[model samples]
Target: MRNPQRLNVPIQLDRDLPEPLHDQLAAQLRRAIARGQLAGRMPSTRTLAGVLGISRGVALAAYEVLLAEGRITGRHGSGTYVSGTGSAPVGAGSLPVRASDVVVDLRSDRPSTQAFPLAAWRAAWRRASHQAPPVEEPPPAGLPALRAAVAAYLRESRGLVLDGHEVVVTAGYADALALILRARHGAGRALIALEDPAPPALRHALARLGTVLPLPTDASGARPDLVPAGCDVVAVLPERGVLGARMPTERRRALAAWARESGGLVLEPAFDGLFNPSLTPRPSVLALGDADSTAMVGSFCDLLTPTLRLSFAVVPRRPAGAVEEGLHGQPSVTCQLAVADLLASGCVARRAERLSVLYGAKRAFVRQVLGAYPDTRLLGGDTGAAAALLLPAAVRAESVVGALLARRVRVADLAAFCHESGVRENGIAFSYGHLDAGLLSGALHALTGTLDDHRLPRRSAA
Candidate 1:
């Protein structure tokens, strides 16, 4: 069999220019490689020179430049090949490269989608698609049916006695936060109070628009005393921490009272605990006598898939108009209808019940595994998708996280969540929602081994 001629790359150079011929040639080849035209094996320097009507020395020099820069590889007997730097050729049937060799994933932000009711959801979607709305544009507050369904769901499950009018639909958590900020402050720097170990995404969202005054937290959650005066908004999770710490009842009241006194608004997330059976429903800030000064955010991400991007905010009557205006576009009509069907037909509740059982068992398994290490303290499991594993003071949380990542198992470092530099809590947050029982077991085994390896040396030295 005869090999085809290797001459796909189209190179043009000017001999009249001040630039060296080799330099111009190399530059052309560089462009070709970047455009993916120069993938796979390249013609030999002698052959390339002959084809391009250039001197063999110039071609060789250009090839040397590419070689030194690690752009191409030269085999002793075989011709030069495009190095791994270039993308695979189009229609070459190259398999998609895996991002990592991750055998188990325990990343905290992810929710469980393994047991999603795909059949029922598809049925709902089909039904929604068939029933087209008379109007193409959805109402800014969402479809009337979805808004009513959301209000009813919250009222029944969370004990909020709110009407459907209070429910404002949003694209997601980020969109909800953006709307809240815009409606309240309207393009000014607002100092917001945030829990020390708040969700990184929330902190990141507020970073540009506001100055975050860190509220230090203990076992019972964010300390009310530490909430600085003059901040306009204080963000917290309803009766819980971002990673599942149960806030004491007194503390919750105290925080609400602080908001009342300071004339600051409270933004409580009721996002993650919908399916947590262990947690008894407490009075939300809206119900606990701070309804006027609080805005509660929740999402279907915990109930369904994150990519669905459906969320709602219980906005007070005062800023209701502005918040509605800020929500410029409506959520997808089909999604709103499907969710409405799920909520109305009680499909969501049934799924939540099953998830409640699964997550409870998974949480217990995690606690049991972490219990083997006496120095490690389990902080929160009352609600939410993840639990915090507080480590001894000396163990660097980032180092252990790095070790686990090296073994292709990922977990969140508790330190990364803290907004304040002075706070030095060390730990990992394990999200068990996404992983199945078998993978969760394997992840725990690897996590325990990594923790042990890091701990033994410090113990011996001390």
Candidate 2:
């Protein structure tokens, strides 16, 4: 067949940006390739390089990433071409590309729907349906049976011994947190300290409740000594999601002591223990600190699925109860009861075990790929569904993130997590919690490609 006319794919390179020139080239080419603009054959490295005013090595690097991702291929000498069959031509007559259609999200908050134990969940719901339905509005604190079950699950899974009455169910972490702040401070503004590099969404949510002081942190997670005087509450993620920081026993001890000495409340978002039969979690700050001065928020989103939005708060015993005096969003009794049954029947535990193995494999892939890169370091590995990589100083996390996102792989810069804008960091975070193994692998490779784009282009020895 005669070669199709060489297409005019608009490839722009801006050198002023922190994102590398090769990365910029790769992103535009990938976009064109996906649209079949480079359907049958692509320009040779030297030709494209000369045309674009970039080095041959730069063109070669872009091609290598696309090749690894199998988006394009090379014959013995015929140049690179799109790999898949039935690729549509770019431009008019072609379907318009929707933003949502092409994004491969790397944010790791949601778990896999396929991995959720559907059979067991359905069975639990069926059992819940068998029980007599409540005529009155269910208690905002949760159904008595569920509270008992939550307390039992906590004791079994987290080693935190508590009474059924102490577990107050809410719609999820947001509700649980809102209720906690209102109950303790009664809707009045209070001083709140949040971990530095906390999720921007969380910071916004807490901002309305009180002044949010950004608490600086290191590899060990949030610094306890920096809690600031008159701070009413300190929020920490024991799992330390994206930062990949694990609070050591000493750090936990120091936090517990801070809460004790200051009589301040410590808010810990506690995911349940690693479901692996062999692995039990270490003590939580809530478990180690004065229980009356600490509360641990728990969510089932990761344990089951975020769709089942039931979450609970293990309130400090000193409070008579977690009073949601004005709150109306307690989760449906059916969800609460069904999850309770899932826990009691060990369905949640079994699901945890399966997920442990699955996520372990995915996390290891992240470790092997991003971690193997000479200058990239993985952080906060022990507790959360998320993992963060600390990139070398030469590469800006924001630049790498932007370049990858342009290539259609959506990953986050640590700067994006800041409450205020324009903070720079050398770290980026992605999830192993609920993402597919394949999607996670591809995103990491694209990340590697973007990082490699920063290297000085190799020139011909001849």
Candidate 3:
């Protein structure tokens, strides 16, 4: 087939240009699309790369930026084409700007939907369906086999020892948190502490039932002193270590000690636990010396398919009865069955291993690109999954976020995560796992450009 006239894009790369070749290509393409210069069908990555005298990877990276932005769409076996208009392209703008619009979301906590192992999942589902039991009801807690597999996997990977019966499966992390809250604090209003800059969904979920307090963190993990005296339930991200320093052993011990003294329950939401490749694996609070007050919970949504709403919480033996009683009223038959098959097929384990490496590479790439902005600092860079860029205090985070959105770069501001006065920080969180190098570079360039264009001059210098 002949190339479409409108799809004939000429990307000029200057050797002297400080920007990377892939980023330059991506930015130019974005400009073309915005100006209606490149319309309808687009060229294949190979053709575009060959025409522009660049590597296929470079061309592909550029294409990924467009894809991430929803400027283009891929047809199986066919070439890429310009996406239809009406809704703004993905990453076209920040969250608030595109509040009602379905933008291609780069700020999502979930893994990239495109990279999901659909074939493996489908095969597993088919096999499980054929081997379906006479009854449609899920196993009491979950499919026993799946629970056992999860236990084994966690033991091997995360070093958490658990019996299959101890693992209670739920719809997702949200549901699991709800169940845990209900189990631990039935009718009583407990003071719950969470990270200051936490995932908004978590804050909303916890706020609905209890007095949610935002716990502050510096280079170390959540400060044990910051955890209010009256609070009995503290929710924390287990590995929120700063740049070079891991969460100190002393700090963890201190937190445990505090929990012990206060009679508080420590709920560790181990988000993206599987993706870390550090030599000394970050231990879960639940794994610390058989503490009866701590429970470790993990969600497969961020690591696997978000649509597959299966999460597990390793409850302390003390709370087992409470958890069981709380979950008795909820119906989760289909969810358990699907999760069981997913575990039995070994697809989750395999994919998780692969994604760990994939996300690590993407995280490194994003850091390399975003590192160009001297004024910006990356939070959680050592963790190799999600990082937040801390902008200068003078910069308007919300406006900058909106500007990025207009350019199709989706990101979340720290303001959304803050609670009460004197806790505001000028920053935004970026999930590197969901984005590739090319898209990341392009987005960074656009974001920096927007910030530069709008940033106020230093008052001292002025």
lDDT scores of the candidates, listed in order: 0.73, 0.70, 0.66
Alpha-carbon runs more than 4 Å astray in model 1: 1-100, 133-135, 163-165, 318-321, 456-462
lDDT of 3 by residue, 1-462 (tens): 233244555557776854457657776776566555665567778777666677898878777767766878887866677666323333444222222232435576657433455557666666666654645556446667767777777776677776422777765676677666776788676689886666777789888768898788777757778887689788776565312224666777777777778888888765544466654665666766345678767777766656666777677554334555555432355455556667666777777766777667766776666666667777676664677778887777897889888877788887776776427778887665665444566666776678668753322322
The TM-scores, one per candidate, come to 0.74, 0.73, 0.74
Candidate 2 Cα misplacement greater than 4 A, ranges: 1-101, 163-165, 272-280, 318-324, 381-383, 419-424, 456-462
Name the better of 1 and 3 by lDDT: 1
lDDT of 2 by residue, 64-180 (tens): 756755778777755666775323444465444453356777764766443345557768899888878777778867888888888887777778876322778888677788777
State the local distance difference test value for candidate 2. Answer: 0.70
Candidate 2 shows a clash count of 4
lDDT of 1 by residue, 103-189 (tens): 456765566644456558878999999975656678777788998898888877777787422778888777777777766788787
Candidate 3, pairs of clashing residues: 69-90, 90-104, 91-408, 91-409, 92-405, 92-408, 93-405, 93-406, 94-405
